[model samples]
Target chain A: MIAHAIFFYTFSIIAVVSAIMVTASKNTVHSVFFLILDFISISCLFIMIGAEFLGMIMLIVYVGAVAVLFLFVVMMLNVAQQKNQWFAGQQSSRHIPVGLIISTLIFFEIIIVIGGWKYKPEIFDINNSISQASISNTHSLGQILYTDYIHVFQISGMILLVAMVGAIVLTFRQRSGVKRQSYIKQISRERAEGVEVLEVQSNKGVKLDD
Target chain B: MEYLSAVFQEVYKILFLLVPVLVSVAMIVWLDRRVWAFVQKRQGPNVVGPFGLLQSLADALKYIFKEIIIPSSSNKVIFILAPIVTMTLALIAWAVIPFSATQVLADINVGILYLFAVSSLGVYGIIMGGWASNSKYPFLGAIRSAAQMVSYEVSIGVIIINVLLCVGSLNLNDIVIAQKNMWFVIPLFPMFVIFFISALAETNRPPFDLPEAEAELVAGYQTEYSGMMYAMFWLGEYANILLMCAMGAILFLGGWMSPIDVYPFTLVPGAIWLILKILLLFILFALVKAIVPRYRYDQLMRLGWKVFLPLSLTWVVLTASYLFYFNLLPVN
Candidate 1:
């Protein structure tokens, strides 16, 4: 229990600091790196808390895929040189109070959710079948995910599929006069079409263009 | 006192696993060079020791003694952190690799997922190093590598799912045990091929080594690194390759299981069987390096996306249906 607490605190602190650094860092690339660090630390916390399946998936999805895409975009855009104007821009100052209000509201919402869970523990007990100790984490999770929440799980997957198709549709383009390889046509070509048996073939070679 | 002893025991086990792995990395490097040389009819690295056994060792010493030149314009912190991250991540995935039924570090329920997650994170090292160097070639190499790895990982995931359907478990030991009757390579031959090819692409081996195409990218992300730093990248790369080979062995070749169940084969320990399997796969990897030509970037992307992805996905469906039809799926 002591070791768990020590690790929990360490990971949480790192996650929190890195979360702050995600926005506080000057360079956009650094911000993305910090974002990745935040994801990793949070995943570490998840793994430490015995939700190993979720933790590993979280690492795979967030740190591996999402953060990599974020870095790719940041690197491609060459935005690291741009000075952050969050604090200094007079023109953007008007939005600060609005941002502060929204952030505080969201913050309180998280606090209330955590506090509710803490105060009313029966809310979790209602679905306690999912956390049976007899089975492994992967088994239990799979059981619940495939059975109790099958529709929702599949619907979310379909939504992701639709989003991917939409993104491809949005970006895809066809350019004119582009020569594309037709594998079938190239492979099916016969020599008979190019080679003709003519009496004056040697002399007619000079008039091949005709 | 008990806690201290437990900690010491864990450390001892880690060292037991890691020291051999590091030594094997050196040996594998030498083997790779020799394989390449044998293909070209030359005696590769034979002067350092007996049959050039200490060539990699001498290279390590030279790297240790060389100067580490950090480019003045580079992002110093990330540049240094990149190779460390690479080497560390490469090594840590070995924690879950089962040499035998009893010889694994963490026999976690989600061991396969942990390996996948760790291996997926390996791209960050190259990306970070390339971007940190602030050079065009390294940056280009990093982007290519990032794209290549990510593209190949999808097919690898689908291929792994085919295996998981057969075993119905994620634990590496469980995977091996489930293969007692027959190896996965026999039934899931197509998926195995896709997995092997994707592993090659994932580890950035030739014909998929567009990231470090010497004629173009000039050592890729390692262009700016020098001394021990560059050596770390080299070590991490070979380690990653070995890890991929081990993964291939575990997933398709029945891991540490002997080829024959007879008395002679059974007399040999499981660890030896596993090592021999890994060495066999590594030799294949080296042979592919020598024989195959490098792929163009677009061709690599096309192969990963257009060909392997759909094929692996189809195989997953087919495997699931076949298992379901025959009631062969392992029930928890």
Candidate 2:
């Protein structure tokens, strides 16, 4: 229990610091790196809390794929030289109050949610049965995900698929006069098509035009 | 006192696993050079020790003694952090690799996912190093490598699903045990092949090593690194290659399992069998480097996306359907 607490505190501290640094950093590339660090520390917390699958998936998806794409865009755009100017311009100063209002509202909503949270008595029964089964964390999660929430799970997957297709559709373009490799045509070339057996080929240069 | 003892024991076990791995990385580097030399009909690194056994050791010493010149314009902090991240992440994935039934560090339920997650994070090291260098070639190499790894990872994920469809468990040990009757290579041969090729691409080996194409990128992301820093990248690359080889052995070749069930084969320990399997796969990786030419960037992307992605996706469907139809899926 002590070890768990120690780890939880360490990871949460790192995560919070990195989260702040994500926006506070001047360099865009540094911001992305801090964002990655934020994701990693949060995932470490998740793993420490016994949700290994979710933690690992979070690392794979967020830190691995999304953050990499973020880094790629940042690097390619050469945006690291741009200084953070949220408070610099007189024009930008007007939005600060609005941002503060919105952020405070979010903070209150999270506080209310945590303050009102309570475990139902039946939840204990469900937990008892799960522990009795002695199944692995992944197995138990799969059981619930596939059975109790199958439709929701599948709908989320479908939504992702649609989003992917939409992204592809949005970006895809066709170029005119571009030569593309046709593997079938290349592989199916025949010797007979190019060669002709002519009786008097040598005399008139095989009547080349004909 | 008891807590201290437990912590010490854990550290000891980690060292037990890590020391051999680092040593083996050194040895594998020598083997890679020797194989390349054999292919080119020349003696490779044979002067230092017997058959050039100490060549990698000697290289390590040279790297240790050399100067680490950080580029003046580079992002100094991240520039230093990159190779450390690379080498550390490469080594940590070994924590979950099971040498035998009982020889795992953390027999976590989601071991395979952990491995996947760690390996996927590997691109950051290169990207950090490249972007931090503040040079065009390294930056280009970093982008190329990141795209290549991410593209290949999609297919690798789908291919792993095919294996999971058979084993129905994410635990690496459970995966090996599920193959007691027959190795996954027999039934999922196509997936195995795609996985091997994707592993090659993931580790940035030839012919997928367009990231470090010498004729173009001049050592890729390592262009600005020198001395121990450059050596760290080299060590991390070979370690990642070994990790991939070990993954192949465990996933397809039935890791640590004796090929034959006879008395003599069974007499040898499981760790030895696992090592031999990894060595065999590593040799194939080295041989591929010698025999195949490097791929163009466009061709590499095309192969990963158009060819392997759809193929692996189809195989996943087939494997799932077949397992369902026959009721062969393991019920965990």
Candidate 3:
């Protein structure tokens, strides 16, 4: 119980700090750094929920690749921009009370809805039957993922396929001057004895430096 | 009250035991050098103590008193925090690894999963350290390291899936015990080899060590780190090598079990055998690094993505069939 509480509080604190930093930064590059922190905290929250695999995937895919792409792009674009331009209009201070009022109202509404509602704990008789109806709960997830969720997975796969194809199309422009290695040429060659008769002579006609 | 006090006493003893194990990683580096020195026909570190037993310690002391230079342009917080992140994450992975039946710090049900998670997080430190340095070489090295780590992690996961197919449990101890009659290396030998190789690459050891290749990227991702910070990365790398070897022992060599204890041949305790296997693996790793030239960056990527990834993917399917058809798994 204590561990769970700690996990929740830790992630909550991290999320809020990163979120605040995202807007508070005068420089856009610094904002992106905060954004990376936000993604990391969300991934940690996934781990606390027992989705270890998903948590790892999130870190490897989102943080490792996507956020990196963002940082690289942001760094490139933000290089010529002035830092003062970002914070000039945002820190007017007149909008603070209005923002606070709206946020507090939303917070109260969520608190009332969650705290005022209570559900009795009743044992579902279908727990064993439904569980047995499938294989291991984990295996059932995999099965459903392939069978029932097959179309959804397929569509997602297709979207990624399209994205990959688009990337190839966009990036495969010809470089007229530069040459790149051809894998076929490299793979088809074997080391041969072409060096036995080759003789190298210093240019005899060239004048030697005294 | 008595039991509570006893728990506190046990924790203290555990702390005392950890001191040696932690120090042993540094000693392994010295032993690793000596082994590789013999392999390569050279004399190893021999000045500090007999066989240079205290050489690594002496180096650590030297690094301690050295000045920690911070570049004026560097992000002070992340630059300082990055190495600590790497060291702590590396150490935390060791927490779930059992030295003996009762010696693990936290032998949770999902031990292997915990290891994978912690290792993935360790990359964050390298990335942040590289970026915070505000240097070109460090930046490029960090980017390359992050991408390479992720690529190999996929292959590692695939190889692990093959093992999980055979063992049918996630716990490290269970995986070890499942090899009572026969080690996984005997049946799933290919996966073991693949996992071991991927582990070396994951730890950024030689051939796969383009991230820190001095000739290419200067000192690579850690070009700007110095003193304790640089020491932390060095210690973390060695510590990670130990963790990988320990995991290999746990997953494939029957963790702490002597091969002959239940197999009608050997009589050594499982713990001693485990240590022996880990040290031997470290020596082998160092030997490979000592002799081989580092691979080019593109070549490393090609081997990881084009070669090991496909090999591991195929093994996953093959192992799954073997388990299901042979009735090894308890699941239907």
Per-residue accuracy of model 1 over B103-216 as CA lDDT, tens digit each: 899888888898899999999999999999989999999999999999999899889889899998899999999889899899899888888899999999999999999999
Q: Please report how far candidate 1 places residue A147 from its true position, in Å.
A: 1.2
Candidate 1 deviant stretches above 4 angstroms? A84-88, A94-98, A185-210
What fnat does each of the candidate structures reach?
A: 0.89, 0.93, 0.11
Q: Candidate 2 has which clashing residue pairs, if any?
A: none
TM-score of chain B of each: 0.99, 0.99, 0.94
> Which candidate's DockQ is highest?
1
For each candidate, the alpha-carbon lDDT, in order, equals 0.91, 0.91, 0.79
DockQ, candidate 3, vs. native dimer? 0.24
| DockQ comparison, 2 vs 3, better candidate | 2
lDDT of 1 by residue, A1-210 (tens): 788888889999999999999889888899999999999999998888789988999999898898999999988764633564544556777888999999999999999889989999776674576668888888888888899899999999999999999999999999999998775787899999868776665645545557
TM-score of model 2 vs. true structure: 0.93
Candidate achieving the largest TM-score:
1
lDDT of 3 by residue, B1-332 (tens): 87679779867866765676669878988988887788789899988988789999999999999999999998888889889988887787877887667766776666777787677666778887888898899988888888788888888878778778877667788788788888988888888888877887889998688888898899888899988789999888888889899888888888888867654445556668889989878877888888888887888788789999999898888877777788776454
- Model 3, docking class: acceptable
